[model samples]
Target: MGDEIRTILEQYALQNAVKHQDVPRAGAVIGAILGKHAELRSRAKELNAIIGSVLAGVEALTHEEREARLAEIAPDLIASMHEKREKSSDLPPLPDAEGGVVMRFAPNPSGPLHLGHARASILNDYYVRRYGGSYIYRIEDTDPKRVVPEAYEMVREDLEWLGIAISDIVYQSDRLGIYYEYARRIIGIGGAYVCTCEAERFRELKLAKKACPCRDLTVEENLLRWEQMLDGTFIEGEATVRIRTEIDHPDPAIRDFSAMRIVNTTLHPRVDATVYPLMNFSVAIDDHLLGMTHVIRGKDHIANTRRQKYIFDYFGWKPPHYLHYGRMSIEGLVLSTSSMHQGIADGTFTGWDDIRLGTLRAMARRGIRPEAVRAAVIEIGCGGTDISFSWDNLFAKNRELIDKGSDRYFFVQDPVHLTVKDGPEQTAHAPLYPGDEERGYRTITFNGEILIPGKEMEGNDLIRLKDLFNIRVTGENTAVYAGDSLTEIRAAKGPIIQWLPPDQTVPCRILTPEGIISGVCEAGVAGCVGETIQFERFGFVRIDAVADGCVTAYFTHR
Candidate 1:
């Protein structure tokens, strides 16, 4: 099996090498192999070692040798090596996307958007971008119980921050009349009826595959009841309009699901409403009316899709192409809106932008790029398999996007003063981007004193003070300047650490998901408010504010 896998691996390696006109990228080769044969993921370590050996051998060969070798191993691949790469690796193409496509991200204005919401919105936005089309932002705020008055705008702000431009803005609350028209039409067609049956009684008959007394009501009679429902004669819980379906359907919940229910107008924050349409009904009506060509959502909506289809079938409307992705559980973050709200109310969190939360606002505060979020979710793709996502994927993407562009600084947390006995009073010059001197540099003057991270500062340890002189730890909170040679420090095999000139430092505090890390950075970072910068020997951070000569930042990631 190893030999067989190795031979196949070699084919891809050679193909990749020849295509690039250089050594093959291990990531591309490995991605190609595992993408096709996922069962071998359990042997990733073994596979990596084998790929390393294969890459070495392939690297030694010239481009011509690689092409000839690939021809012998897999003759058919050589022809397509120069051809354009397939779009299959990206989000799968929308089915029936020929004459352009219309899509929407209908988020209920319940609270701010979180990472879970990003998956659906990103996929929809991705398809809309792939084929130029109108993307609608629909706010499903009809259910007044779930509506947050402020959330109506917060959702838009969050989406905009994620770089999604809304071509059309829709509010379901403003479309009650449209829903009422459809409800009337369906009732006139005998596809729906108003039921005065008690909630428990309907559930009992639905379980028995039996119809309630309302099932036999005439269209005129149901319309009268619907009017009564609309006129507030039938208060909340007395009557609900239910769409007609086969009572004996395998899924009991699908049998005559509620379409519209009565609710008091005062309970709503935005608009006065006597009747509220259920989620599936409102969604189906909006999707059809808005001319949606595709519906991308989570698998949890499968039952809702089945229920919504009854409306489509009744109205003789062609349902959009519905695609459902599996559940993706984000690790180490809470997506519960209620918890977040309560935390804010009780002072457990600062606000919606708390680092501990999983809202997009929180991510932005921590300097995680919108592109990284989209790329991370897109890499997850629209697969119907439950995925357990770790933050490593998102952090890696964010690091790739922000690494080189970010200027570097020095921050020493829990700083201890290291008095270097023989250090000179000289200025230290460090490039804003290491090895990119053309970008410019920042200078820090030292008076033979520096602040270093107190962690693991052992006595007699030869340490490189980063771009400054080398030092030997003499005792607790004390060190002697040993030498100023990069080669000498490298040869000494000592730890290299970041230092801040005590006289020219700014008080700094970095807010992380866990807690606050208070430290001091160079004076230059004071002017870097709103910029993402890397702190030497520390993680990347976004400078949130610099006030009163103190710097406050949010930790992006390592």
Candidate 2:
């Protein structure tokens, strides 16, 4: 036996060893085994208790009213079910220390990691790190057309950006043989079969509320057809592997569905290897083989979970703990991965981070922090698959979280000119953002050359720099408007605003993944490259990159 098993045996044997009635010599030998096998003995006792309880429960359930009793105690059932609940307080904790917790962040790699992806990735990374568990980075690139190297690269970049380090990168493409093996095993178990019905026929069957003819194929024929599909004898869409399941199970998803199909495309990232090409079957097998302990993903995939559980049952592998969370959606739009990619290409969105796209990356670019998004997901919880989202609700959550700690900056849409006549031009200054106790004020010089909001500023007396001192304007020598600044200035009715000194070195352009955006203030003051900050009046800004005396930033409109 291996050291771990041997040590375990010894420890358990020592603890439960026969008591010595003979002498001290016998006692010493038993004591030695007890010392070595103490841990296993404890584990054995715990396992025995659990087994006994389960057996007793089964025996009791054979009698009547068992369901009623279970229902009565169901509230406390999960609470009583314990494995381990140790929480890691740091990012990237050791995997082995976490009671063998294994986590995976599987991204489709169709586009960049959005806010949703970031949240999911971070959660998995954190949990795995905390428990000292293995954090596996898996590429869910089963779809041929959607899988792109750029998308995969961006996934890696986004994670590194957020300080998440993943080991054991596994691709679904590399594990096709394992998936096919499991599929054959499942078919042998009579849980899967080959279907020759066309797509429309299956649709008609669903609409007519009946099972398709291909649903009852014999195991031998089905296996032969599966081989034919692999050998290219069966044309694409001509045949598919469908899992045998109940049709009238109340839920439409439980109805027999295709497990594998030929998409007839060589563009797949993994297609170069000429292997199996379906998502559900590949995921089901790969997850089991990888020893995934829990599957945390969007609720939209919950339907797939039922089918996957069936696969797990057919293979005699325990289905992992499945945790479904809400997807990022908006009114009049579905957050489908295909749709998002189309939006990116069609200019319906600038890119994945397009604030209007409702993508997680777009959400992040639009000023929604990763933490805020996760909190929102938690608040929304998981509600089946179908969900109707309102942009207002998500914005409200973001606004609440951002308003607390983020500072604000001033951004005048149309800046004007004002030549103050003989004025007492004291320097006006204000904090970079409101409610910032630690941030000192930024000073702006009036210097008899104040760019107030009007061309005809002869009659105007005061020039308020906003949150700073209100300066008294002297006479003007021929005032001229800059043509860009707002000309019409009303009488003061509210607090004046703040402005950066014209001489301050501010970034000019902030380029983001979404698109290019002009920067207003100093590069560091507004935001650093790849950093997020709130512009006082213009909403959130993400600093993309910096170049010769210019910085690229994307404005996330409020």
Q: After superposition, how far is residue 189 of candidate 1 from its true place, in Å?
A: 2.2
Taking all chains together, each candidate's TM-score versus the true structure is: 0.82, 0.64
Per-model C-alpha lDDT, please? 0.86, 0.58
lDDT of 1 by residue, 245-358 (tens): 998999998999999998884478867778989999999999998999999999999999999999999989999999999999987777899999899999999988999999
Deviation in Å, model 1, residue 344 alpha carbon: 1.5
Candidate No. with top lDDT: 1
What tens-digit string does per-residue lDDT give for candidate 2 at 42-101?
454443333332322222221112323333444243233222333333332332344767
| RMSD of each predicted structure | 8.9, 23.4
Candidate 2 weakest lDDT stretch, 10 residues: 481-490
* lDDT comparing candidate 1 with the true structure: 0.86
